[model samples]
Target: MKKLYHNYIDTFRGLSLEVWWLSLITLINRAGTMVIPFLSIYLSDSLNFTLPDVGWIMTFFGLGSVLGTWMGGKLTDKIGYYKVMLVSLLGTGILFVLLQFAKTFEAFCAGIFLVMLVADAFRPAMFVALSAYSKPENKTRSVTLIRLAINLGFSAGPAIGGVIITGIGYQGLFWVDGITCVLAAFLLLKVLHPKKAKILDVVKVENPVSAYKDKAFWIFFIAMFIFGFTFLQYFSTMPLYYKEVRLLTVLEVGLLMGFNGFFIFLFEMPLINWLENMKNSKTKLIAFGLFLVAISFIVLNFTSWVGILIIGMLLMTIGEMIAFPFSNAFAVERAKKGNQGEYMALYAIAFSLSHIFSHNVGMQMVDKYGYEFTWNFITILALLGVFTLFILLKVLKKEKNT
Candidate 1:
């Protein structure tokens, strides 16, 4: 028992203080992430938009994200991550407040597009900042640490959001979310102020390759896009399923979603630490994670028992814990050999594109063919992603040997 306790303690050793501060800022920003998780419900329930309309609005959200990441990547390369992050956080905070007032479909679409554009710009900049803050050897663990903070925040956010929805209404979610983003921005400004902090740029390339020119990376990008598409259903359609089929209250649904975050918080770091020691292939682990997520979706089709929801969420959370940090580490490592901002931007864009397609496509599938069919379809797609990852693993190995 003492050995086990020490192992857990050892898992957190050697990270720089800046990484911890970055994680804290991420936690604060994400803790107020009440808006996105419940956006579909808000649009459908409050504004009375049709499913197709909701999907279109979400597509706009993705479009903004895609452009935002691209723009942020270029800006980070040109100006630096500090300025990009400051602008993104402050701008996103203001946008959220204004977005809540947009009632019409057109107005809401524009508002969400602008909001995500500004919000997602933070992603690549954060990755760049993460690279600057941590040593190469600690990359994956540092990513896992950030994920732990994100999950911890996520676990709390939904529960708090549910209560806010119940007590004051959905509008309250916007206010809290906005306030938190602004708070995080100020906190970042105070602590990691560019003048006071000298971040070592760990990733420096003499002649960096563009992300678009990398063939193996594009294959990996596709797998990540599919992975994001499938995993995101937990946030988008799964809540509606909990509400409609399972007859769960909104609060119950929030708690159920929170379970994923809580599970990740508890198990991910130790698991990653153990895996890191094994010196296994990152791509293989990611493929395995994809397989687990595929199983998570298919499990829903096998039973209607309420216990199955917990089982499915557990599978998904474990898959996320296995996949995300390694994927992030891989992207960062690859960027070290190439253009850091460009490579990380492309990585962020893959998930952002998935945001474009996941919510709308899942809703359409569920609406047209029922939830069972949708689950089956997503399962098939996820398996395809797993196969693609195996291909990437082979390709990466070949490149390394050459």
Candidate 2:
């Protein structure tokens, strides 16, 4: 028992101070992530937008993310992750302030687009920074450390957001979020200097276009996209369902949203470390996570009991705990030399593009066909994920043997 405890402790050992600081930056940034989770509710209730209109507005946000991620990745190789990360953080912080003014539909869509465009860069750039700052053997844990920070912050954000909505309103939510972003950027600027330290001294830039040519990565990307569509329902679909069907209040929805992050914070790093220690069957682990995600949705369809929402959220959190960090770690392993940023960016596109499709499909179905059909469709997507990922594993195996 003592040996096992020591082994678990070792999982967190030896990551550089830079990695810890990066995670701290992420925690501060995510702690103020008050807008996105409540976006669907805000649109429907505040703006009085129709379900379809709400879907498209969020879809516009996704489109901006797609572009932002692509640009961040492409530039990180040329400019370095440090600059990209700083600019993204500072730029997005200002945009959050500007977003509060975008009350008109066209203005709101444009605001969301610009916000994601500037903000999403932080992700791929951060992935590259994680690779640069941490030892190769401890890569997974380094990423998990950042994930832990983000989840911890996410757990706090909605709960605080719920309180703020009552006292300060939505404007306060956006302003507070902006302040956190600028604060994180300032911390990064004041503290980090990896170039002088040579953490990134051995890097070499690969052909930026090379990621698209990798058959195995393309296969993984497709499976990731499908998995992401269902995995991201909490942001796009579930909030609306809880509001319209479950009749939950904003505070109740905030608690439910916070539940996912709290559960992830409680379970993910330890669980991921344990899973890695057991074996390296990453694809199997990911597929299993996808299966669990599908089952969470199925639970919703089968029961109207509010208790089921908690169960569903817990199950989905477990699945994410299993899958998300490993997914990022595996993508880092697959990068060619110094193109880590680009590869990580492509990996991010899986979640980004899902925003475009998942919201539109989910909301339209809910409006036209009802909520059950939306859940059923998500189940089909999840099953497809299992099948697609297995094929990706085979491709990966073949690539390795050659």
Candidate 3:
């Protein structure tokens, strides 16, 4: 046990102080992100909107994400990540607070759209910041460390959010989320001041390749889109599953969701550290992760047993631990060919695109066909992502050999 503890501690030994600060900022911001997880529920139960109405609102949320990420990428390349991140954090905080005033369907849709537009811009900027803050050799681990903080915050958010919802109603979530975002922005200002942090523009390509022209990256984008589309169901449909199918209470659902974050917190960094040292093929690992996600969905069909939910969540969490950090590293590496902000923007856009369609599609599918059908559909999509990523792997290898 001592040996295990030391090894886990060793994984974090060499990261820069800036990277730790970045992770701290992410933790603070994400801990307040209890709004998205329960948004659909709030729309459906609290406001008495139909599922399709909820779907449309969520779709608008995705559209905002797409536009926000695109704008963020452009601004990051032109100005710098620091300013963009600072502005984004403040904007999103204010927007979340204002959003609570919108109660009608049209009003809520517009509110969410505006909120996400500002909120998602932070993504590409944050990626740029990560690149600026990290050493090349430590980049992947830095990504993992950031993800660890995100999951740690996520683990706490849902439980606290559930308590808030149960005690004070959903309106309370907005205040907490908004306050946290603003607080994170203040913290960012205090720690990551341009002069004090000495942030560098590290990689300078002699001839920068355009991210738009990279065929391999386009393929990667597609696979990432599918992965995001499918994985997002965890946030979108899975909670509904817990509520309707399992008949679990809101607190129980929150605890169950928090389990995924907690599990990743406990295991992901050590796993990432080991995988990096083993020199394993990143593409293969990602494909395996997709396969596990497919299995996670399909397993629900095999048994109605409530325990299957735990098993499925475990599989999904493991898959996420494998897939996300390596995928993030790959995007960063690819971005070296051109503008880091541009390439990372394209990467962020893929997931944002998923945000646009996945919730609406999943909700509509559930409404039309049922949960069983929806799970099957998502399972098939995940398998397709696995196949697409393998193709990307082969193409990358061919390019290297040529």
Candidate 4:
């Protein structure tokens, strides 16, 4: 027992301070940004907006995020990661503060769009920085740790935000989010110094046309696009499903999401390490994860019981943890040496496109076909993701032999 305990401690200690700090920053930032999960609730309950209006507002935020992610990648490459991170954090903080003053629905939507744009823009830059700092062998673990922190923060944030929303209202949520953003930015500025890279030093004004030409890149992007379509349901439609179909209380919904983060925190590191050692290919892991996710949805279709829902959520979270970071690491590994930023940018674009398409299309499908149909649609997408992975594996194998 003592030996096992000490080994566990030593393993944690072996993780770099940079990884720890980045994870901490993610935790703090996500904890404060609780508005994301409850945005539709705030619009409907607090702001008295219609469902369609809320959907439109979400579309704007998605559009803004698309631009933000692309610009963040380009800026990181052109200037430096540290500078882009600082700017994105500070800009998002200012926007969140402005959001507190939004009285009209239009104003609230506009503020949210601006804030989400900047907040999400920070993501690609952060991903690039984390990847750059990690050794190739450790890169996937590092990314998983960061994602675990995000889930931890998310788990706590919504539950806390629920209490705050119940007591003080949406304005309080905005204030808390803004304060956390400012603090996270300050900490990041203090700890992260950008080491100039050769890519940034060189002046290449050419379009990233070559990045789009990589067949593997396009295959990966398409797979992520399919993944995103299913994934976005968590944000846009799942809460409504919980509320309307399952008849869950606000606190109950928050607790369920919190549980998701808790699982990620507890299991992500061990799972990533285990997966790394598994003889199965990364593509197989992804296919397996998607299969689990599809199975979870099938489980979801039959039950409105909270216990069953929680079980399904657990399965989904495990699948997501296995797939997401691996996809990211694969993209980075596949990039041309000097074009890391461009490759990551395109990868980020896949996510943005997924969000836009899913939110807009998924919501409509939910409205028309109901939750069961929506889940069925997502299951089909998950199966398609598996098929894509098979194709990707064959291509990777052919390249390897060559």
Model 4 misplaced stretches (Cα beyond 4 Å): 1-13, 166-168, 195-209, 239-254, 301-308, 336-338
lDDT of residue 186 for candidate 4: 91
Q: Return the lDDT, model 4, position 112.
A: 74
Residue-level lDDT tens digits of model 2 in 218-305:
8889888988889878776798888888999988987887878777775676788788888867888888888888888888989789
Question: What would the TM-score be for candidate 4 when compared with the true structure?
Answer: 0.88
Q: Which stretches of candidate 1 lie over 4 Å from their true place?
A: 1-3, 44-51, 163-171, 198-201, 240-255, 303-306
Tell me model 1's lDDT, rounded to 2 decimals.
Answer: 0.89
How good is model 2 by TM-score?
0.88
How badly does each model clash, as a count of residue pairs? 0, 0, 0, 0
Question: Could you list the CA RMSD of all candidates, in the order they appear?
Answer: 2.4, 3.0, 2.4, 3.5
* Model 4 residue 277 CA deviation in Å: 1.8
Each prediction's TM-score against the native? 0.91, 0.88, 0.92, 0.88
| lDDT for each residue of candidate 3 in 1-402, tens digit (9 for 90 to 100) | 999999989999888899999999999998898998788789999999997798779778888889989988888888888999999999999999898899999999899989988888898989989988988888889999999888878777877899999999999999999999999999999999897895544887788888899999999999999999999999878999889998999889878888887888889989998889999888888888888988999998998799999999999999999999988999998898888888899999998998778877898899999999999999999999999999998899999999
Model 3's number of clashes is 0
| Error of model 2, residue 196, in angstroms | 6.0
